[model samples]
Target: MKKYIKIARPDHWIKNFFIMPGVAIAFLLTEHSLKDINIFKLICAFFATCMIASANYVINEWLDAPFDKFHPTKKNRPVVTENMKFSVVIAEYIALIAVGVILSLLVDKLFLITSLVLLFMGFLYNVKPFRTKDIPYFDVLSESVNNMLRLMMGWFVVTDSSLPPSSILIGYWMAGAFLMATKRFAEYRMIGNPEVAGLYRRSFKLYTEKTLLASALFYSLISTFCLGVFLIKYRIEYLLCMPLVFLLFSYYVAMSFDPDSAVQRPEKLFKEKKLMLLVFVIIIAFMILTSVDLNFLHRLTSNSLVWVRLD
Candidate 1:
């Protein structure tokens, strides 16, 4: 019974918190005031995202068991280590999806559709015939799409009638891609053998450490550029948070180089006190930026020339 639960990988649900930024951003942009926001619906949206994510995890674990056997630590996952009933695993997957659908229905139509797309992406990623996870860079891009989907889910929960700014969505997608690429880079480094890593993940067949690092850099650049557009277009105050955001990404990249890096186990990342502290600071900064009117910051975006004299 516990093995069934473990296969669902509830710990990975922390990734669903990606939805929070969407919700917050949507609330800030929408006509709805704070009093108009529905806390119950927000909770429902979050849990719905969790359930669908768990459903995906269940299928992923079951399908990847064979490949995971080649992985050092993943070889011990419940699916790989224990005798699992195929029927039970399928049932669990369906049950989780059902729960997610029910909860999503309570949130909004757009949320429900986005939740279904997230589930479908899991199939596209883990299932045969069309498993994009086997296709090198596509693996990262496909998996990273979940980040944008979660953001959309959060946005719809608050205001299904409107869409988030495309700049922010693009920025969020590239940020997720950057994170996924870094995870791949860390995993490749930890494996330390291309052949072994390739056996564990088909995409690794063509992914050298250098290639992954290069891709990560590319994604980060795109992310920052689009996010910059978002900050400038929506609220110049957010530009203040950009430096800390860059610092956060830089710190994450540095940590990926550590021996047996924590980047490999994102769920365990909370144990990194410094990283968590930085995240907390960034969150506080965002909250402050969102709440206050920093109209003066717009002057920085103006084309006005400043008078200067060289001494």
Candidate 2:
């Protein structure tokens, strides 16, 4: 059981939280109308996405076992620690993919398409021929595209209308891009050898700390600007929330520079007591303020429920 759990890398499952952005965006754009919320569909879609993402992680670990063995922290992973066998990993991967596809098909055609795209992307990330991580710009492009797809998946699940040109989507995309660049930057910094860095990620050779830092700053600024616009357009007055976002980004970047921090996985950052408390409080406050009345907080909640039916 321990081996299996380790193979699952439940710690990394936090990335599955990407589902929240989609659901949040849908709510922000529509207002929190329970009618259009389709709780059943949303729950299933979330689970399906998690399974598919888990499968990708399993496959990535299996394929990168050789390389991971040399990675300082990754060497402790189940696959490298020999806690889990390769054949077991492969079997679980197949099972996860099968479950993910079946659940997606049960939801709708759109979900099926999303699942297919995710599968293909996951394969490309590790497969020999078109290993996207081996290319320079393609690595970032692929990650960004995947994030866009995840957002679209959430958007389509709720509404049939074309996505509005809201600041929400822009903020999401920019935030995702910022994180992707930071991850690459961390990789480059941790592994001093240029060639080895390139072996792990093609983008490492193409990106310098200065370039990534500049890009991260740019994206963070864009995300903050878009978030403000989203608040204004929705008549949400909780602009104070902006500072929390800034703090989060700043802390994340600072952590990326620490060698000890590099040994920790990205998801673990969320588990920090202070950070988690701050995030939870901010989110709860936003939800309450937006959903309560016509105040800024209420307006924010109202926007999320735009597609919801009162009846």
Candidate 3:
């Protein structure tokens, strides 16, 4: 049972939390939005995404079983270690695919569409002739698209009224790009030897440390600027969170300098005290800013439905 659980890699599900940000963006605009949410359906949406992502992991592990033997950290993965039976992994993958698809079908049309796109993208990343995972920049770019799909899924899970603001989605995409780039950077640094890194991740063979860092910096700046636009267009007071955001991003960059930094596995943030506190503070500030109806913002932004989009 423990081996089975390990093979599922539930720890990676933390990435599925990306589904909530769009919901948060939409709810912050709606009156009595909390009451309007479908808690049960939202919960299902979360689990469905987790299952879909897990299924993808299964495919990856199965395909990489041979190559994983050469990877330093991945050498101990269940597939490589043979701690879990391949038959069991295949069974779980089938079950996950069924459950994930069925759950998505139970959601609304938009939610279903987003879920399918997420699944399709996941397949492209790991499997087939065009496996983006082995392609240098394309690997990260394809992986980042999952963020937009997750965000859209969340947006539809709560309400089918309309889309979240463009600025919000763009910011989220760039932010994901920033994180992906950082992961590549950490991989390059931690692996130390270029040849070793290539064995673990083929794309690393095409990336220099300088190129990866430059990509990370470029992505973070674009994400920050888009986020700034989002806040300004929605609530000017939200701009106060900028300092915290800057600090958090800086801390993340500093952490990436360490070969074994938790940044590589963002899910490990739960175990990071200082970073978690900073994130907590940021969340609290945003909650307070959005919980109330700020009249001026509605008046300031055009498209009337722009800020809260009450229409």
In order, candidate lDDTs are 0.92, 0.73, 0.83
lDDT of 1 by residue, 1-311 (tens): 99999989888888788998898888778887668779899999999999999999999999999999999899999999999999999999999999999999999998999999999999999998999999999999999999999999989878878899999999999999999999999999999999999999999999999999999999999999999998878888988999998999999999999988889888788899999999999999988988798666666446333423321
> Which parts of model 3 have CA positions greater than 4 angstroms off?
83-88, 291-311
Candidate 3 local Cα displacement, residue 90, angstroms: 3.6
Better of 2 and 3 by lDDT: 3
**Residue ranges of candidate 1 with Cα displaced over 4 Å:** 291-296, 304-311
Which lDDT tens digits does candidate 2 get at residues 184-263?
A: 77767887777776565556767777887787788789888997888766645557577878887887787778775632
- By TM-score, the candidates rank as 1, 3, 2
- A best-first ranking of the candidates according to their lDDT comes to 1, 3, 2
Q: Give the top-scoring candidate (TM-score).
A: 1
As for candidate 1, its clashing pairs are none
List the lowest-lDDT window of 10 residues for candidate 3: 298-307
Of the pair 2 and 3, which is ahead by TM-score? Answer: 3
Q: Model 3, 125-190: lDDT tens per residue?
A: 888797899998888888988888899898888778788888878888888888899988987887
Top candidate, metric lDDT: 1
